[model samples]
Target chain A: MKRLKLFPISRRAKDLLAGKLMLLLTILAALLVLLMVAGLYLKSRPVLASQPLAELLFSTKWRPFRGQFGFFPFIMGTLWVTGVAVLIAVPLCLLTAIYLSEYAPARVREWVKPLIDILAGIPSVVFGVWGMLVVVPFIKDSVAPFFKVFSTGYSILAGGIVLAIMIFPVIIHVALEVFRAVPQEVREASLAVGATRWQTVKHVVLRKALPGVAAAIVLGIARAFGETMAVLMVVGNVAKVPGNVLDPAYPLPALIANNYGEMLSIPLYDSALMLAALILLLVILLFNLLSRAVLARVERSIR
Target chain B: MDRRKVEEGIFRVLMVLATGLILSSLVMILLTVLVKGLPYLSLEMVTQTPRGGYYLGKGGGILNAIIGSLYLAGGATLLAILFSLPVALYLNVYSRPDARFVSVCRLAFDVLNGVPSIVFGAFGFTLMIYFGLRASLLGGIIAIALLILPMLIRAMDEVIRLVPRELMDASYALGATRWETALRVVTRQALPGILTAVLIAFGRGIGDAAAVIFTAGFTDAVPTSLLRPAATLPLAIFFQLGVPVPEVQGRAYASALILTLLILIISVAARRLSRRLTRHVVK
Candidate 1:
């Protein structure tokens, strides 16, 4: 009886300890989030209040020194590059995922999946270096010349292509998981109804996996938007909105990186960079929230 | 029969191309870095410091950057592992069945992982400056810890949850304390998975660039002290890539190659370890 009593008491104490620890971690994580918000607001309040956010949003010029802080060019640059990246990545990712999950032999699937995942684990800086050396040069010497009107190189096309290469793995990984999650019987039933293998994938598998595929595409977009080193290295660091694919332009992160050191030497300039950080953070956060919502929807549909 | 065979052949070609492209990009990038870097790669290049400071063709070895990366990544991994293990265990064993808090914890990790590395860099830069830490290794370590923490939690939590329920039931029936069950039974069962988590987190710490960039000021000196400023391979590449001369730029390519090789080795090790863990689960 005494032994039994001791067992229950100890188990209860252990459970209590676990609960406390979990609570602590949860509180700590929440505090970090709060701290990040507070830090940004603390630094950016003066800039946020003194200047209208709308003008900052719509202004074509990004000269922070002269206080002409329009973010239109940076915003447009990020969207255009990411738009191109997604347009390239999504279809390739989906096709690969469908082929690997539904059509490939089991032995082939085993080998192919890991190779794709390895691409995801490679560092972005490596991609940046590779892009600057190989991809940018290739675009300059070969691809840009194809566009007769564009006389020079090191442009948006180079950056977008490199980014698309980087995010392709992510899209394939996520979409492959989605494709694999589709029940076997669903495919078997479609096939049994005399639908071709292509028809089964295009009509049934894709339809079922659309939400997950959408989530993967959105995640890819968010990743492309926030990427720094690779884009900075390959985008030519030109600080204007591009007129064509060959025109060089800077994104928000690039602006922060290029100007942060010089800005730190000046007083209000640091605050201005903080303003850029604030904007960049908010854009990423909004996209992240949207992706999570889509992911949740996918899960719900699965259940 | 002919039509069916033709369609199948087309699908096969498409699949091959899709998979082929991913591999080709990887090979292309690796070859580019290596070819550009190979001419400058030498024992002297890695062992000595840059003599010309920021100038071309005269800088010594990348020794300082390599050492700094190891020290910072090592320190960050230690801190992150300490923070993650207990938290993961608590998450798995604690909480009422209806508790909303576990879900919130999961949400927190998701949000944390989703935060851009650059934002972490900015936050670290501001906080460290405000707190008088300057651009020190501690600052970099903390920033990296924050970045790795989410991945560790998710990985460990998944492993712990995957521990078979029967093990817990048997241990409890045999009068083992819940703590004993967790430490001896559940954790032992999930050892491979936990090891995979730690390894992956370590690899991530080693490879990460953006989070450490602002916190660890690029210095030329070897980092014997964690508080001293230092450079990393990625930062070296970043700084040197902007060098005006061809020779110096070629050196940046070499440094990038070295860093890329390091990242590839570590990631391959992680993949192998994860594969082993999955195999163990099947057994």
Candidate 2:
């Protein structure tokens, strides 16, 4: 009000405001990223400081109470559970995506897609509850009996099955997108070669969509690794490294979920959880970067 | 030919089974929760504060938790929208084309999107405690706002970019100022899409429990104030009934079902509304 200037919207003011907003957002993002890095660093220092890094890296036990903190068990547990999940999910998800994209009538795809979308919208805790009551029991009574040679009770198998169910939609959504992105000529050319419908999908469509499929798989792995509630509820929460797929074992995220709230506000425990979080963040970030790279490669290859 | 037909038939069956299993999991979860918790879902559960064991049924109701969820999520959504919208607008308008600033913002948004919720919770806990807020709803709202801000900005930027450039030209040709044109014409026409972005972010915030868990420490007796601790449905599921009690477990299932239904309904509605608006604009 004090200024009746001819050009109130000065160039300097515009640039200044833009610079200030950019600085604010950058600082916030930087702080969040730094906290994650620092938190992990502080948390993992004990293990990192100990001698014989080889043993720590290769050891199967994760007895932090006695200060024997080998991450192999946790890492293996995560991979095994998620691998089994991917094994169960990938085929089913691909099939569903194919059915939706290719086989299903338009109206049917429309109906199914929204349901899948809504399924994704449901909270993870609800899935956890469902896993606890329904999935765990099914595993306990049905699958465990068949797998008694390896494990007679709740195991990674149960957790993996539940996780597969949880992540199926993500795979389907991404795969469907990739399938749709494949060019029409490829499909027609493959069909012109007298390939059956399945052959066209298997050879032409899926091969063309391989890069996207890889991205989707990596994304599914990322989601599975960070997931907490459902796995914690069904995995039996054992802290041991499993010798077989049927054995109960803990993953890093589940450990944090179960122990973070209970641990006294001590630096060691806080750092431990933070270290676990750091590991999770790093794994997820690495894969995210990998997917971006894959997408970039796909763009390049296409061009 | 017969062999190929048989193989195709088998593949079709497997496809149906795959779809069936996914659908069944969804149905099974919903049906199990509804069957177990439906009878217990009374007006009191929705209206009053939670008491002791759900069986004893002596507590007030879930009204406080519901209100806390609404306020925390609503406040977070508002802040995210408030900050991100303008920032997105500025980035769209002021930043030189292909500038380092724009790329940096894009990278930050990507990192934010990929940063896990638990990590966000830990950061919030440390930073809020450092500020002496201890665990409160404001802290939770702030944490969620951070989590949703990147997504909000990206969505808003997309919708804003979709705003036709001819409109900008028209306004400028009329001797309207830069601010006036942006505020009056472009924004007014882009309002629906922006609202859609806000709704999507709000829905995402509402369903999020990890970001809220550490920032808003769980409280049993309804949140009397923003400074006070509060229980959300997701937190309640994680904390209260995570044990082996039947009644408590029942209550948790009921709460989970309710929370899931609310989020799903709102998210679906928001997404459909946004899609409709975009389609209308395009037409």
Candidate 3:
């Protein structure tokens, strides 16, 4: 009997040991983000020390061989592409989400959900290939000419259009979830009060889902900001701030990707590129944190 | 009242149009790839490595890239599963539901999931320099593994969290220790979800180009060792498209088609496997 009791204690000890092992692994996994931030910062310190942060961020000069690294144009390029993408994607995705959630039949919703998943699953490189073969030609041949502007088809608009398409599935998926999360009774109550379907969607459903919708948009923007290969392929990598949507502009990711191989040849070039990556990481981190905070608040309020 | 009705009609039409537009674009993308790729895709293109002046529209296939991608992503997935399973299990089983540490870890994973693949590439390159490692298959695996780690863990966590609590209680009632309950009962119950998460991470890893471009330097031959430079299908497409040769460009489309088909198969398999595995599931 005493031996049997000791058996249970030994089993308990084994359980405790297992728990401690898992805890250590979990902590190591969680510390990866901190490791990435610290590594990038330390590598970028040379450029950060040589130039003032404001000058590095705000200056327009970018002579890599001469050791000058102004990132203002790339920053602006990122903003322009992401801004245009958001402007194009949000309305279309929101409308699509509304249709799927409120208007489409259950069968149709089931069919379309998988389609959106397919869209999301399509690789970015494939999208770049399509953008190059189709969107760029269309822009150069039709859209730009119609707008009375000349573009080589590689411009901020091309990047934005491709990016908008890439982000459509992301926004639509999230927005559909948000819309579906609205209690069925809430919709019934509005309808019972003689509210039109559109009215309920515009007023009550939208109101209840406003935070989620905002979170979706923020997520899309974050995606647009950091996309590398597709945008790099389409956005003509001119090292100047784009004056209009049709102008070719270089974004930061492209700068890092295109020049990383050759950066070792030039002084502070690697540092500058690392700093670009650091900035990208910081911005994306901020956007993600903000969206999470917004989501958490809504979840708490709902509870 | 009439104006409101008109407004409703207009918005309804707008919604339908927007949805139609999105659907049409999907169709367009698929058609573009199929139409452009079919003519160039041959059995040889899948069988042989690139020969002399392949970029010049000469005789050769992308077997190197196809094989290399499989190796890189497959190795990375295995590596990620090693870390992801333990972390995910810990988050769902070893901690309290409302534990502060658990929430913080969840939040960290969420943020990490949003970090772009390019950042991983850049960071991996930094590590490579520090460790005096060259761009090789091993480097690519490490980079892609990190890129997919958070995604893998979060996906598994979501699935493991959905396992019925009562099932765990029953395990405990049977005199199973917490570790036994977690490993045997919880994991068995969540097997379908765990498999789905693993496949999703594998798909993401294989499809990703930004994370592997710098870490996996292009090579004509298949990777023979972990330290050798490797080619991937996405980079193959990118490089081939950059060439001004029309035939080379056509091969790029073919490569994209191959990659797309691989992803489609994996996704289909994941759905089918999960559905089949749920036979013993309680609900």
Candidate 4:
């Protein structure tokens, strides 16, 4: 009887210990985010201390040699590519969401949803290869001739188009969910008032879902801003202020990726790259918080 | 009324066209990669390492990269599962779903998911520098695991959430502790979902180029130790594509072909497993 009692007690103790261990592991998962942010900020101090923020933000030069370390061109490059991507992706994604949520037949929706999922799951390197083999050559052969000078097709335009394609499915999926989440009663009320289906969607459903749509767009921005390999491969990796969409330009992710291996040879290069990583982190964090704020408001409305 | 009718028609046509565009693009990319990469996919590519001047479009194969990729991704997947399973189990079994702490933990994972891979590479580089650990299999594994941890945790959490509460109550009524229920009953029910989460994390880790690019230094040999420099398939493709030779370019296509095939197989398996999990669960 004593032995049986001890066995059960011992097993209960083991179970309690297991629960504590899981709590520790969960904390560890959260700590990793804090660790990354702290590491990036703490490590970037040397470069941020030695250089003026004004020069780093405004100057155009990015030559690693001769001690020049301007990041303006890279900042511009990141903005340009991401801006073009947003311009191409937002309208089309919104329309696709409307169609899927409101108009798609059940069978078509089932088939199409998985297709988008497959697209989202595709590896970035495959996209890079596709961009390299198909998009760039097509642009060079067909689009370059119309320009005043010859272009290699490996330009910001190519980068943006590829990024647009990469992020399209992800953003549209969220938007579709948001649209579907509008209360059915609200749609019925609009229809009872003699409103056409299009009118109801435009005035009532979309208006109710606007905040969620905004959140989705911000998330998509956060994604495209720091996208690395696919954009890096097609963007031509030139360090210059892009004169036009067809001009080759350097972006921040590409800059860090390309020069990372050789950073040891240059003064403050590692620190500079660390600073770049810090900026990317903070900016993405800001966008994330904005979307979270909007999403919270949405939850409040639902309640 | 006429103007509104015209507007509605135009919007309808445009939306349909957008859907068609995505479908055609997916088809176009798959066909393009397959057409260019199929002829070069041979057993030689899987059986031999690159010889001298391999980057210059010479003879030999990419066996080292295949093995090295498997090591880095495989190691990362194992490490991520260690952390992810505990967090997921804690959320679904030990705590209530609507608990404030649970939502906060979920938020942390969401933000971590948004943090870019390049930034993870930067973080790993910092850690390596501070510890005096040069690029190695271990360093790369840690970086990729961190990069995929949030994704792994979230996927597993969704699966765990689907585990019915009645089962836990039943186990408790049977004198089973919370941990016993979680380990035996809860985990048993979530096995397929857990496996699918593993597949997703593995796929994410193996295909990532930016995150592991710095932490895993390049080599032409298979990784034999945790402390040695390792190569990966994405880096292999990147290096070959840079060689400016048509022959080497073809090899890049072949490497990409292998990588894409691995990803496709994993994705198909994951979908299948998730479907099975839904049907076979709690029956």
Candidate 5:
């Protein structure tokens, strides 16, 4: 401790200075998060206040050009697309997770896990282009035609399919963690009772990991809900509630992403999109927090 | 017993099929892009900017977008690292494991991370309008920095948390200050994780389009300053895909291929480099 003070600052004071820097940095991070939420609300206040919240949420019509700004079509579009995505994805993801955790050898698991992660990391824009160039054409040329439905390449089915593929990895990754958390002793005990390996995974592992799996599914749905570019590219961007999977739909993110630029010129257009963005933020935030709470509880048990 | 056996076999088969399908999508996604993009993947395609009528499948390349994306994502990644590193360090170093502040911060990050990238664009648009900032590279960088902050910080925090606390305590007991312990000991222990976090942020920042779409303001020319509008690979793909021409659509695939390849290189390098860095770590 017998050293010359650095510019009149003591060692304890230096420690305090370092601590203060960290505290300030943490405060900045928190403030930034708050700013994002506050910014959305304040910016959208005009549209949010002008109409009843229920009307904006439940009204079936949306006409930006004629000044009608009911966002129900977009909300339903988002729900229909995300719901179909989760519907298509959850079962597939759960099965894959079970296979990875129970059936695959250690060597196989190591190689396969990274591929799944890479799938998760593939950019939305890449997926968007692929959907535009391939999936839409396939749906139009084959899938929809086979069903004898009136179809454009871009429709809710295309959007949902793209989202299903995109959200698969998120669900599978989470489900894997859940499955791995199932105690080895419990698995052995189930097998010892003359249960088949598949039986143990089905009855024991599945039951044990149900909550985590649900959380995983919720996370996937949240991601599907929030997705913008890919869904926008494939969903046909029509501001109407999709009648069926083959119908064109405009999701909220798609609506915002597509029109926010031109919105500045149109009266109340910017505010409407801002309100849509705010709704998306709230929904996604709720889903994420719910999933996080579940995961946290599961983590405690697994630990 | 016979029924159970049949069900088990059926389920096993279904599992294999499901896993196979999931994995094949990745291969299919990659192969489709590679096949469609390779013919258009020439030096000229990478070297030249879009000439007039470029969207109609006319001459020139996506050079402006390529450079501009590198600039914006790269700049944003750098900025995110500076702020995220400290926040991550603060979470792991300055606070107890179950501290309220730490939990609140983590929860906040969760919410931020959950908020869609397009919302970030909206928020950025809001702030830019308020501050009199035009759509430019700076606006995009800042927006993307905010977008990736939670991701980067959470990733780094996870990595730093994995470093054994005993190692940090030992460093502090050796008369090293908290700053020194954090800088020299904790950072070294988690170097690989930090590198991986940085790489992930880089990949995310580069690949993301929605957050920067409103803020970046697409341009055909490469940005010469932070104030100038910039073109990103994702936006380039979006614009080209919008063109009705088949030739232009092929270029969209080509651009997506380029963007995918960049992310691939970063991930591959990060994995290999992380493995190498772990050789020096005590863990």
Candidate 6:
């Protein structure tokens, strides 16, 4: 009490000041996404104003020098690559999550957890390098030829494979958390009712964890969609709609990454690129919000 | 019953195979980097800046990128912490966890976390153009700081939330204000977790490439001022690999090796440091 009197302000005032400051910071943080969206949208207004949103989104022509910016190709490219990645990654990750949650010994689980972290921690550039060195060549020489297709390996399939590997940790980590959140009593009850271990996991744990798993998959799709460097390295950056997995695709992030620097001099080029970024931001924002809502529901249901 | 047993055995095998496949990919990625990089990774690669025709397989090292990345990530991490710590503390100590404001803040961070690094790069570039700032270390720092801020806050919040309510109550009973209780007691209790969060942000900041690519203009010289352009190892790897020369491509592997080693060291050190600091934690 004696020391408290040394302050120029009352203790209550100091506490209020600190609390206010923290609240302000939190508010600022909460407002950042809107700030980003507004900033990007303002910058991209030129292109958005020049062309109809539908034409811009649905048009496949992407001639910047000619002042026509059609994002259809890039949008489709992103979808194709992300689609391939999600298709390949979900089953593999779900199985691994189940094994770790339902079947693995404690020692193995301990070892794999850190391993997943390390995998997740590996820089995207290194993954790019690995894809460039191994996956691309293997696809070029072996996989493509085995399918009797003559192709350069830098295709949507290559991008998808690399993206799938990059997102393994994201999916597996969340899936593991979701699986663990399934109460042990549920499992025990299933076992007591004469369900085998695998049966219990399939019927009880998996059903309970379904929403969480879907959320995880959504997060993974968000990750794969926004991935830039590794996909850029392998997914031959041609500005065309990829008809098949073997064709080159220019994804939106890649479009922004590859051209934003060099083509600033072109009329409306930067705006088009900003519009691409806005598209990516919006889609990712939608996915993240959706996943968060689903996760909240899962938490509520669990409780 | 027999058929059900067969199906169980089949699924068990599938699960094991899937797990093995995932783990082996990690091993394979590491092995590829090491095998391809070791031959080109000379001591000079880390010590000297690039010389004339370095990208042509002639001479020099990636020291510029090495130091530049350290500076950029270090600066960004510090900047992020300045903002992140307050938000994290406010969430746990000053505000109700279930408050609408808190949920909105948490939701904001989640969405921001999911926003791609390329989007950050684009947004940062837009900001720089508006402010008439060139692509420089400062520009990169601001971008990466924004990129990692949400992550840092969320991670710190998770740990700070775990601090026992009783600890804060005891501090309050001793006539301490909420400010003092938060800064001294709760923060001290969550020190290790805070450290881990900081290091994780640092790791992410350093390893990031797409966010910095446009904002951090690459330069051969090491950056001496915040206004100057700086190179990063990931971009260095990217540029080297793009050259058609075999030797330059080999150097790309060397650069990737350096970057990977840096991240590995950061993660390992984070774990070790957290373990050491845990002794001081009340829990």
Please give the distance, in angstroms, between residue B177's alpha carbon in candidate 1 and its true position after superposition.
Answer: 3.9
**Each prediction's TM-score against the native?**
0.93, 0.89, 0.98, 0.97, 0.97, 0.98
TM-score of chain A of each: 0.90, 0.86, 0.96, 0.95, 0.95, 0.96
lDDT of 6 by residue, B19-91 (tens): 9999999999999999999999999999999999998888899999999999999999999999999899999
Tens digits of per-residue lDDT, candidate 3, A164-258, equal 99999978977887887788899999999999999999999999999999998998999999999899999999999899999998999888888
Name the weakest run of 10 consecutive residues (lDDT summed) in model 2 chain B: B52-61
Q: Candidate 6 chain A: worst 10 consecutive residues by lDDT? A: A2-11
B142: Cα error in model 5, Å: 0.9
Over all chains combined, what TM-score does candidate 2 have? 0.89
Off by over 4 Å in 2: A1-35, A42-68, A149-153, A265-267, A299-303, B2-9, B52-58, B96-104, B169-187, B275-283
Name every residue pair that clashes in candidate 4.
none
Clashing pairs in 6: none
> Per-residue CA lDDT of candidate 6, range A68-119, in tens?
9999999999999999999999999999999998999999999999999999
Interface RMSD of 6: 0.9
Where model 6 places Cα greater than 4 Å from the true spot, the runs are A1-8
Local accuracy of candidate 5 as per-residue lDDT tens digits, A165-262: 99998899888888888889999999999999989987898999889999999999999999999999999998877889999999999988998568
Interface RMSD of each: 2.6, 3.1, 1.1, 1.3, 1.3, 0.9
DockQ of 3: 0.77
User: Which 10 consecutive positions of candidate 2 chain A have the poorest summed lDDT?
Assistant: A262-271
Q: What is the fnat of candidate 2?
A: 0.35
lDDT tens digits, residue span A2-111, model 1? 99889878777876776677568657864676678689768877667767889877788766667666778888888777777787777677768877888789998888
Off by over 4 Å in 5: A1-9
Number of residue pairs clashing in candidate 3, backbone atoms closer than 3 angstroms, sequence gap of 3 or more or interchain:
0
Best model per DockQ: 6
CAPRI accuracy category, model 1? medium
Cα error, candidate 4, residue B167 (Å): 1.9
